[model samples]
Target: MRKNTVGTAVTLCAAALLTAGLGTASAAPATSPAAAHGAQAQRQPRQPVLVDCAFQPQARPDAFILACGDGNSRLASLHWQHWDGRTAVARGVNLVNDCKPYCAAGKFHSYPVVVRLAHPEPWKKRPQVRQFTQLSLTFTGARPAGYDRVVTLPLWS
Candidate 1:
């Protein structure tokens, strides 16, 4: 009976401290369901991006230039199908210059292709940003003459 009385008194005192918000905070209180969900959403990983030649991170970009020096090669009318941390897939038109006689007089040619961006790594300029480092184009039907069916290129960071 004495032991029961002491335990009961301790329990009552602890309960009173908690009720008055004076209890030790070593143990965190249970979180609400909404708060837990919000925390999960916040913890979700951010999607990777494509960095342009000017060193800018872009998400779901409609167009990306392959040749930054002369701007002779580029992709346009991009329709992105997938974008994630590992890879990104898109269907677009690869506009390349013929450079038949000279680049100064070169004419742009459009070829249908399926584009894939992979090999994501942190950007050198901005370590916090991850960007696609490789680009691949698979010609759907007709491809540029002297060009293979599939071509892979290193993207500029």
Candidate 2:
């Protein structure tokens, strides 16, 4: 019985390898722009060169936006910036109840689209710069208030 099992395992392994090789050999050429760049060979997704801002309710900052996917909302501050020279800003308004429909908070609200803003210029700390470059929002309210998360556009890596 043991020998039979071993033989079966070897056969399975050989079949798997053969199938893999054949699959690759028979596959058509990549047609996407990414494929043209030979990136498919490495099996990596094209990372967007833009900043993303959202609130994480589990990581902390109970009422604010957090960077990484944590539940807490307080730490929900502007955490990352991309190469698109865009940063995100919170709508600035806080929801009276996290349960409100479209509220930044939702039931199981595991993933709520928080506030995000982007600036075209490199994110530079200057007390004088005003007017954001580009703005996109997934927020609870229209008025930017106390619990919103806002960040400057990323000019750096």
Candidate 3:
């Protein structure tokens, strides 16, 4: 009986070692639907926001003015980037250390802030503006400090 018990234990131990050596260590197979969907999402290309301009001549470079929410005077600064032909991106930040009267006081009305390109106009080799076209806006980041909010604007010229 003692010999039989010893032999069984040795066999089990040997089997475990063999499995490990064969690279057959157990790993949970990804079988959940959420896991599969998440993987697929990662593989898919991201989409951009589409906007239509109603203002005359649409909103063009050095002409598109942005009206950001005002009141707290927390607005720190504004930056703009020109893309392709009909798209513009603007980012704003509230660079206030403390929400005091010195930095941010009012927090009610919307402030009309205009943003223009640092580059010269007349897109030399670019296509001529004819009419309003579809636009896309993608917001990247936002926080209480620095430029955390990004706005994509649509303009025609």
Clashes of each: 0, 33, 9
TM-score of 3: 0.22
Better of 1 and 3 by TM-score: 1
Best by TM-score: 1
TM-score of each: 0.70, 0.23, 0.22
* RMSD in Å for all candidates: 12.3, 12.2, 14.7
lDDT of 2 by residue, 1-157 (tens): 9999999999999999999999998896758896666855333222222322431111112244333244433223333333222343332332233444643554432223344544444323332222234434454334333434433322222
Number of clashes found in candidate 2:
33
User: Candidate 2: global Cα-lDDT?
Assistant: 0.39
CA lDDT, every model vs. true structure? 0.87, 0.39, 0.39
CA lDDT for candidate 1: 0.87
lDDT of 1 by residue, 1-157 (tens): 9999999999999999887675446556788899998886554336777888787778888998888999998999999999999999999999999998999898999999999999998878766667889999999988888989999998877
Residue 126 error for model 1, in Å? 0.9
Ranking according to TM-score, highest score first: 1, 2, 3
